[model samples]
Target: MTATIPAQTGGDLPAHNITISEFGAMKALAILSQSGKENAGVRVFIKSGGCSGYQYGMAIDDRELDGDTIVHDRGVKLLVDRMSLPLLRGSEVDFVENMMGGGFTVHNPNATSSCGCGHSFRTDGAQSPDGEGSGGCGSH
Candidate 1:
């Protein structure tokens, strides 16, 4: 189920549904290169169960799961599984650095509301279409 996202920048990858900012790509590349893993990439996924019904997760993984959407930016691979693609469509992956601190940030167009922590969000009243609400981060 692997998909090659066309490169939006300088790479030869297929276009990706999600775009990674130059700063984000550089940051991710640095982390992956220093991770001591031979061929590691960044994995970004969404899980159902954040304060806003959905939470974003990221990590460095050496393996590519089936059905993963692989996008390359600034020599870094951004791996996103199929199920999480729709939730992240049209999103910009960015890395922000400031006096307060610095970290990865996802500016998702699909998120209707997000938690103060910026790691959880609700999708335009669709997170729970079955009339039942998903619990938040504290519930876990």
Candidate 2:
């Protein structure tokens, strides 16, 4: 989650995933543009749902509480809520523009299992496979 990314330039656009360009950052910018809010953002997190165990939820909001962790990437800034951060610690969110399944995808190394629907993932207790889920996995 604390990966160090070199600064971005107007010439070199930042990147989150190979398939989808600026997954979270682009989504954040898009949300800001629509809300017409100067400092708004898109928040991505996992919730207890779907056929598996957890599902990805995204929303556009213009509010920031005290315990939010912000990830600034590719000229776009995103705010991840405190509660949600635990489950999504080291996940790399990607945007996949595919005919079969095209949308923002979370490359969660923590998840032990992910449903075939590309949503809902489950991880072991405190330890994920890759140890990225230092915050522990969310429960249903």
Candidate 3:
């Protein structure tokens, strides 16, 4: 079960999108249910300045913005704002477990280079702010 939410066009909003795997969908549902909020959902976004030029941010939210792309899957809603959609388009949200632990992982196809941690990534040849190494979620 794979699903994608594409940002709307012809509006004063940004256009970006994201996909989710079955595992990710189920995990989102579980998390939301545990939060005890009837309208709780996950908000995924991108912020500037990581080890890479951009970084991912996520949190459980109950409010919906004016220009949010909502992906409904497995009884869970994943929200992506207009400004953050473009950077996340074609990316996949997944959940995995390892000896270290488990969490949601985003497989972004737009990434040109990523760090060893798989949390932060670069899409173009953009350099880090310090002109040294980039940092973020990890890498992909």
What TM-score does each of the candidates earn?
0.82, 0.66, 0.77
Point out the higher-scoring one by lDDT: 1 or 2: 1
RMSD, each candidate, Å? 3.5, 7.6, 6.5
For 22-129, candidate 2 gives per-residue lDDT tens digits of 565576466578887767655777776655556778766677767776666566555667677777766666667777756667777667777665666777642233
lDDT of 1: 0.79
Model 3 TM-score is 0.77
Instruction: Encode model 1's per-residue lDDT on 1-140: one tens digit a residue.
Output: 78877557644423246778888988988898899998898888987776677778889999989999987766878889998998988777889887969999899988998877687788886655343335554642
lDDT of 3 by residue, 47-70 (tens): 765566666778899878888878
Off by over 4 Å in 3: 1-16, 129-140
> What C-alpha lDDT do the candidate models reach, one value each?
0.79, 0.59, 0.71
Clashes of each: 7, 2, 12
Best by TM-score: 1
User: Relative to the unseen true structure, what is the C-alpha lDDT of residue 57 in candidate 2, on a scale of 0 to 100?
Assistant: 84
- Give the range where candidate 2 is weakest over 10 consecutive residues by summed lDDT: 12-21
For model 2 the local lDDT of residue 104 reads 69
